[model samples]
Target: MKLLPLARQAEVTNGWLRERLRAVLPEVMRRARVDLWLVVAREYNEDPVLPSLLPAPMMGARRRTMLVFHAPEGGAFEALAIANAGVGLDGFYTPMWDKTMLAEAAEDQWACLRRVVAERNPKRIGVNVSAEIAFADGLSKSEHDALMAALGPELAARCVSAEEVVVGWLSRRLEGEIEAADGINALAHGLIAEAFSPRVVHPGVTTAVEVAWWLRERARSLGLGCWFQPSVSIQRRGEHLGDLGSSPDAVIRRGDLLHCDFGLHYLGLATDTQQNAYVRRLGESGPPAGMVAALAKAKWQQELLAAEMVIGRSGNEVLRAARAAMARAGLEGRIYTHPIGYHGHGAGPMIGRYDNQEGLPGAGELRLQDATLFSFEMFVEHALPEWDGQRIKLATEQCVAFRGGEVHFLGGRQTAWHLI
Candidate 1:
């Protein structure tokens, strides 16, 4: 797969950051009903949402970075940055600090922030403080104390948690970001394809760990990075599911079922994917009928879940409806889907977890909105007749975008198994 140079990638990413600030931030602030949003972070102690807002080529926050967004009633929106001088953020945010004034004993950083807030006099002053979402809970104890002190009680009384604003900004994807993710997801799938093929796997000769490392190395070669370690495991006849795929030394053999879970990030977007493969034995042109049927069952389950992913529905609501549909179809499976973006397990509502299929609390209760991305992750196990009633588990995952009331897979999902 072809990839752009590092400098070119940075250029593209910085462009998207500017677009997101110009077009997306105001609408998201309106949706969350926040008039003033303040994001405070010290150098090296960056907030989760801070990196998303930073321009490319900048990895950490500068000394005492204070990002202020003001969209007061019937006034023009503003994105202001109050950091030390020459921070290189002036291109994106309107700089509100003057180092020269501090030398003359005019005003401090906190005093400048107070002046900005007083001038805006917004009805709802939003700060990064929340009990539910980690992305929104960025303000540290010391910073919070200082911020409250600087606000001088009157403005402090108007402070509210900016959880909704954080969620809105992080979850919402732009056309360019989504389009970049398509190629990134395809790169992930291509790496998996190569690792599962005979080019890397040698049946009884290659160990599962070797293949896993091969995947990791291949992603690195393409200038991409994995958010989690790539994992590969095996299942064979006469073995219980619990006893399979645990050992790092398990060697791949003919007639074995192989599974892998891998995730990679590039250009500020991430993808989480899980797929399986089948190793053909002697005198076998393909996998057995039972195995084929099991894969088809998984496909149907994916369809069931996709049809229920509508706009304005909570993640729990979608999970419940999908589970009911799966039961009616007599299928046994688990769904643990999540949003994917700047972070691997990105923000937004979580459909379900592996252990808890009933529903999730807090994050799961959040509703789904448009222009968001998700990893439609799930698995179905079938008792195969070819394996003497032993069950085979098949897991499928693909990155998808929810826009205009529909889910579009970034890279097309795996419909057929990778045969080695």
Candidate 2:
């Protein structure tokens, strides 16, 4: 695959940021009942939303960077950057502070922030603070104290947590971003295919760890990175491999069933995928029918989960519906799907968890929205007759997007085992 030049990539990223700010930010603020949004962060301790808001070339937050977004009752919002003049936010944000301006004024940046807030006198000012979502809880104690001090007691009273706004902004994917993510997901699938093939795995000679590192190295070679370390594990006939150990020395042998959990992070989007592989034994022409049947159950569970992702339903509600459907179909499985985009385990509602499959308390209450992407992650446990009635866990996670009330698998899902 051809890669974009650094300059071109920056241009694309800036364009996406501009579009998202224009389209998503205002609507989210309005829905969340916020008239003003303040995003402040130090240099290295950047907020999660900062990367999405910043211009592409500017990798991290600058010294004491403060972004103030003001949306009035009926007009277009204003984006103001209270930081240095030339950090590549010229078109998107109006510069509110510079070194020369600071030198002229006896007051500091906080004073300028106060002036901006006092001018607007917004009824509701949104800040990053929440107990439920970590991505929305970016404000540090010191930063919070400084903000309260700058705004004074009365104005600070209007401050509200921006959890809803931040969640909406981060989870909604623009058209261009969705297209870019499609390419990234396709590349990830191709890399996984290569890793499972004979080119990288030499049967008994290669180890699971070797294949895992090969996948990581392959991603690096393509100028990409993995959000989590890639994992490859074996599930033999009688041996129940608990925890799927990450040891790099577990050798790959014939007749062993292989599973991989991998994800790639590139161009501001992340993908989480899990695929299986089967090695051919000396006399066997293909995997046993019972093993194939077990995989079919996993696919069926995926379908059941996808069918429950209605537009306005909460994640917990969806979980209940999916479980009911699975019960009707006589299938037993666990669903732990989550949104994936800016972060690997991205913002929005969490369907279920590996440990807590009943329902997540606060996070699961978040309703599903359109134009959001998710990792359709789940597993099915069933007895395989070929393996002496031993039950196996067949887990699968594929990147999918929900738009126009339809769920589309980004770059398609893996239905058949990747034969080695």
In model 2, which runs have C-alpha deviations exceeding 4 angstroms? 100-106, 245-248
lDDT of 2 by residue, 308-349 (tens): 999989999999999999999998888999999989999999
Error of 1 at 69 (Å): 0.7
**Best candidate according to lDDT:** 1
lDDT of 2: 0.87
lDDT (CA) for every model shown? 0.88, 0.87
Model 2 vs truth, CA RMSD? 1.5
The weakest ten consecutive residues by lDDT in model 2 span 98-107
**Model 1 CA deviation exceeding 4 Å by range:** 100-105, 240-247
lDDT of 1 by residue, 341-410 (tens): 9898888999999889999887899999999999999999899999998887788888998988898888
